[model samples]
Target: PFTPVEHDTTQEVYTLLHSMSHALVSTASDQCGLATESISEMIMPAIPAIVLYAKSAEHFALGGMATLFETRIHPWVDHTIDYTEQCLLDPPCSRDETGAACHACLHLNTVSCESMNEYLDRRRLVGGYDSTPFWDI
Candidate 1:
C-alpha cells in the first residue's frame, strides 16, 4: 500500500535527477568535445544534488571537465535547463503521465548512472502539466 506509493514518489524524484544528469552530460559533451560516454553522473535524489563528472579513457581526462564545471556551472545549468525543457519527442512525452523522456532525451549509458535508467522523465526536470520543476533556472 504505502510501499508502492513511496516507491513511486522516490522514482519520480530520481527521474528528475536522472533527466537533469543526462542534460548535463549532453551539454558537457557538446561544449567540451568529449563524448557523452566520457561524462558520468552521481545523482543524490534525497539531497537533490547531481554531480556530473568526466570519466575519460585516460586518467582524469586532463581536468577540462573539472574546469568547465568549476568555472561555468552557471551557464552550464542554464543551458541544461533550456535543453531539458524541450525534446524531440515532445507533446506525448511531456503530456503523458510518464513524461516526455525516452532513450533520445533522458536515458544515458549505464556506466555513468547509478540508477539503471529505470525511472526518468525530462518533463520532471523542466515542468509538465502535472508537476513543476525544482529549479528556477
Candidate 2:
C-alpha cells in the first residue's frame, strides 16, 4: 500500500534524479563490490542533488566505497546517465502517464530509499513523452 500525495512538476524532477541515483547504486554495487543494501541515497530536491553513500554494520567502514567515489564516481555517473537515456521498458515507461517505475529498473531495497521507491519515472530522467528531463533545464 502507498500513500497518495499531490504530484507536481517539482516532485517530478526529484523522481527523475532519484531514478538516476538508483541506477548509480546498482552499477556501483556491481562494479565496486559494495552490496546493494550498503549503498544508500539522499536526494535533496531543493538543491537537486543526489548524494550516494555506503554503510557498514562493522566498525571501521570499508574503504572500497571511498576509493570508488574518488576514482570512479565520474565514470559511474556517465554510465548511469547513459543507461537512463533509454530504458528497456520504454514506450509505457516513457509515456509517464502510468507513473512508470518498475522493479526492472527503478526499484531498490526498501531500506536503501527514503521514499520507499515511490514517485520514480526514468522517462523523466531522459525526457520522454511530455516531461523534460531536469538535466536539460
Candidate 3:
C-alpha cells in the first residue's frame, strides 16, 4: 500500500534506501534479534551509494556481530550513518523528532532539507577515519 510518486532514478534510489532501512529495522526488531548474517544482507545494498557516493564512511566498522556502519567518519558520513542508525534504532515510526540525528529524510527532502540533513550539517564534526581502505561488499 505504498503511495504512487514521480518515477525517477533518484526517487528509486531513495525508495530503495527507505525499503532497505525498513527491512533491517523490522528484521532486527522482530524475530532475528540482531545477527551478523542478517544485518550484513540488510546493510550491503545501500552502503556504497548512500555512504560512498555521499562521501560518507568507506568501510562499515563492525563491532562484534552487531554490524554498525561507522557514524563517526566524516560529517556527511556521520550524517548518513546517523540517519540510517536512527531508522534502525527507532522502528516503523522513524520519527521526524527523536533521533541521535535525523538525515534519513534527506532522500525525500534533499532540496529544502527541512528535516535530517540540515540538523546534521549543523552538528559538530566527529574525528578519526579515512576514505582509504574501502570495504567491498
Please, what is the whole-model Cα lDDT of each candidate in the order they appear? 0.72, 0.74, 0.30
TM-score of each: 0.79, 0.78, 0.24
- What is the Cα-based TM-score of model 3? 0.24
Candidate 3 achieves a global lDDT of: 0.30
User: Which sequence of candidate numbers ranks them by TM-score, best first?
Assistant: 1, 2, 3
Worst 10 residues of 3 by lDDT: 119-128
Candidate 3 residues 34-87, lDDT tens each? Answer: 332223221232342322121113343233122333432344333344434333
- Residue 88: error of model 1 in Å? 1.2
Q: What's the C-alpha lDDT at position 59 in model 2? A: 38
Q: After the best TM-score superposition of candidate 1, give how far the Cα of residue 66 lies from its true spot, in angstroms.
A: 1.2
By lDDT, the candidates rank as 2, 1, 3
The residue ranges of model 1 lying beyond 4 angstroms of the native Cα positions read 1-9, 57-62
How big is the RMSD of model 2? 3.0
Please provide, for model 1 over 49-103, each residue's C-alpha lDDT reduced to its tens digit, 9 standing for 90 to 100: 8887777556556477866767877887788878887778777767756557677
State the TM-score for model 1: 0.79
